[model samples]
Target chain A: MNKIEVKGLYKAYSDKGRRINGYDECRLPEGSTVLHDINLSIKRRSFTCFVGPSGCGKSTLLRIMAGFEHPTKGWVFIDGMPVNGPSPRHIFVFQEDGLLPWMTTRENVALGVRDIKDSDERRRRIIEYIELVGLKGFEDHYPHELSGGMRRRAEVARALITNPDILFMDEPFGALDFLTRLQMREEMINVHMMFDTTILFITHDIDEAIQLGDQIVILSERPTNLRADIPLAFPHPRDFTKGGLAALRRDIYFQMGIHTAL
Target chain B: MGEDGGERKNGFMKGALSKCRQADRILPALTVVVIIALWEWVVRIFSISPGVLPPPSRVAAALWGLAKSGVLFDYTVASLFRVTWGYFLAVAAAVPIGMFLGLWPLGRAVFNPIIQFLRPISPLAWIPLAILWLGIGDKPAVFLIFLAVFFPMLVCVMGSVAGIKVTYFRIAQNFGLTGYRLYTKVVLPAALPEIVVGLRITLGTAWLVIVAAEMIAVKSGLGYLIVDARNSLRMDRVIGGMVVIGIIGLALDRIIRRLETLPSVRWKRMQR
Candidate 1:
């Protein structure tokens, strides 16, 4: 079953001088198009990775799907209903600095389950989610006090505690150190395995897309259109140094205008 | 053998650290003492008349006299009462209006020019009008202090709210928080650190205005004490009043600063 469907999606910015709020990274000139006729279908519980070039509007696309911004013209349907604005059932984990710096880890995680009427049940779930993200002993620490990776974990816990049907992550580990990014990727996979929620992740790193994606959607440079949609059925601990994964990696590099032979 | 050496080194470092902290406390006191001594010596060397520039001893004596007569306490309480009322009133009004303006661009556009225009005009300019409208006593002084505090605090609160990271709003929206819930749960807490800073700054402005306000509009505050003392040719009492004002200003600043140390808002300091 398809969890989300994007039909004839197109986005453009009419304001030339002023930068758009929330999409500060992608500054377009007057009437310049971004995503051009983007169409995608994300299956339920499948981890889809969006890989694109810099300023290719991948984040814009993700934000549009999450209803943070409206497309110039198109429709995004989640569970057969059109998305009007951001909904509680769909959570977005921003690339960085998403955790409220003023809030403790416990308080931030509790944000998702704030509607739970039962106090004991809410406390239990908040603690459970905190432990699930391996932030047991540091519940009282603010976002600034936690390490970068720990802050990311807290954000993920906050998102997951709501049990959203679709989790939109925009380059969640882009700011982490190499070792922390690798560790987070493993933890991310563990999270996917443990939860039944569908995940839509955006990244510019090809290796990250190859490693974490169940289906990889490649996007082209400005006025971005869907370049390729490749579904990887490879099992866990799949080696990318050799075999089909390596060849596929080379193919992606070539398609992205990067020569691996160099 | 190495363990004992490490312990000795640790003890040395601890002792050095304590000594450094002690220096931090003592240096300010030492400077105050030196300045007072210099002031006294200059007064004695110049043989300055008491009416022109009283020595520290005479100023201290005058302060002791006020303290004994209990007028100092009364003056201090009056000034504090006006400041407290004016500052709280400004805070109560400015925070809500600031939030509204900060959140609503159209409203901000409508009102920002008026605020900016009024902001540059000194609060002293309002003295005649305050006196005319409210008459004498604490009312006019409080009104002037309110005028002094309200504009800057409004601007500060608005800036603080506007400065909140867009990501936090996105998170709030994603969680379906809207309207009052959004303000109470997300906006208030997120803008608190900056608001507390704003409160501290505006309180300083309020304290400054109160003295000037009291000099013209009221009869019981420290400002009145200084002016009334000058009328009687008591330079010592005037200086003493100034000293008391300085001390109370420092105390108010210290109290507001403690709010910044709260765990919820402490991230501002950490970020710095």
Candidate 2:
């Protein structure tokens, strides 16, 4: 069964009137379409990557599915129920620093599960997740005190500790330096393997898409629609240097209108 | 082997931290001693009139006299009481209202302009109105101090609340937090560092206004002590009063600084 389904989703922003020739003009708000007719379903316990150029509305589509945004047309369903608003069942990791600065690592990870009445159980799970994210000794450190990669790990732990059925990340590793990015990617795969939670990750990096995704959804430029949905049946820890992945990479670049050297 | 090395590292870190803390205290005390010595030298070298600029020794004598008479303690208590009540009251009243204004656009639109207009008109200007409205006593003085703190606290807290990154709210929502939980858990903590900064600045202004307010509106505070000493031509007492005010202001500011450094809010000053 599909974990999430998006059907004919559309989103648009209305630009407020701007001054022309130094005169205050009352122009009608004109809609600039961001996503057009976005349709796809993410399979259960799958890692799906939405790859596209910058400003291609992949994040918008992710937000709409996460229920942080509303689609101008069409619908999203989580387990056959239409998504009306944000639910704890789905956690969305923002691209920016989402960890509350005032909260320590333990507090940030524990915040989502605060509703749990059992204090001992809550503390135990918070510790477990902190250890899972490799933030064992830094539980008392605030987000600002943590390095970029550690902050991202804390954010991911915060999301996962909730044990949501699906997690949506919007270019989560985009801000990290190269070595840290590689380390975090390894940690992320370990986490996915452990939790087995379905994930929908959005990124512009084609290499990242191939490295992490079991299924890659390619998106077109502005007024974005799905250009392709390619599924990989390869096992975990696949070698990127293999002939098959190289061919796949060339195909994706071709789909994105880039001619690869291969 | 690694465990032993880690233990040795921890011991070294503790020793270094203690040494640094000692330096922090000693440096400030040394600066004070140096300043007093310079003042005593300058006064003697210039042969300045005692009425114009009394030596530090004379101010110390005057301070000792006040302490022996118990008048210094009384005046300190009076000023401290006014400042404490005024500061707490403004915080209590303004924080909730600021949150409301920050969250709700209509409320901000309606009241912001009025607050902006009132904020710039020095709270000293309210002395006449505070006296007329509340009558002579600690009440009028307290009112002026409250007025002095209220607007700045309100403006800063409102800005802090409004300035919260939208992404945090989305994260809060994603966690199923709404209404009060959303605010107390996410919004409040996120905005707290900025709010503490606002509180810290307004505290200095409150201390400043209390002295001025006490001089005119009340008859028994540090401000009154200074004014009374001036009228009696006791320059030593006047300088002593000034010294007491400076010390109290510095102490209050240090207290706020300590609060800002608490583990909960210290993220505002990330070393990086």
Q: Best candidate, TM-score-wise?
A: 1
Position A103, candidate 2: lDDT: 81
TM-score of each candidate?
0.95, 0.89
Docking class of 2: acceptable
Clash pairs detected, candidate 2: none
Q: What is every candidate's alpha-carbon RMSD to the true fold?
A: 3.1, 4.6
Least accurate stretch of 10 residues (summed lDDT) in model 2 chain B? Answer: B263-272
For candidate 1, give the DockQ.
0.64
- Residue-level lDDT of model 1, residues A1-262, one tens digit each, is 5899999999988864336334345556678889899999999999999988899489999999999889999899999999989989889999888887888999899889978999999999999999998999999998887888999999999999998888999999999999989999998888889989999999888898899989999999989999999999988877787899998889888888898643
Candidate 2: TM-score? 0.89
**How well does each candidate reproduce the native contacts, as fnat?**
0.75, 0.69
Model 2, B111-206: lDDT tens per residue?
999999999999999888888999999898888878888999999888888877677778788877788887788777777888899899999999
Candidate 2, A1-262: lDDT as tens digits: 7888899999887745222211112232357788899899889999999998877388778888989778899999999999988988788887867788878899889876877999999999999999988899999988887888899999999988988899999889999999988888887788778886999998888888898999999999887899999998877677767789978988898988897555
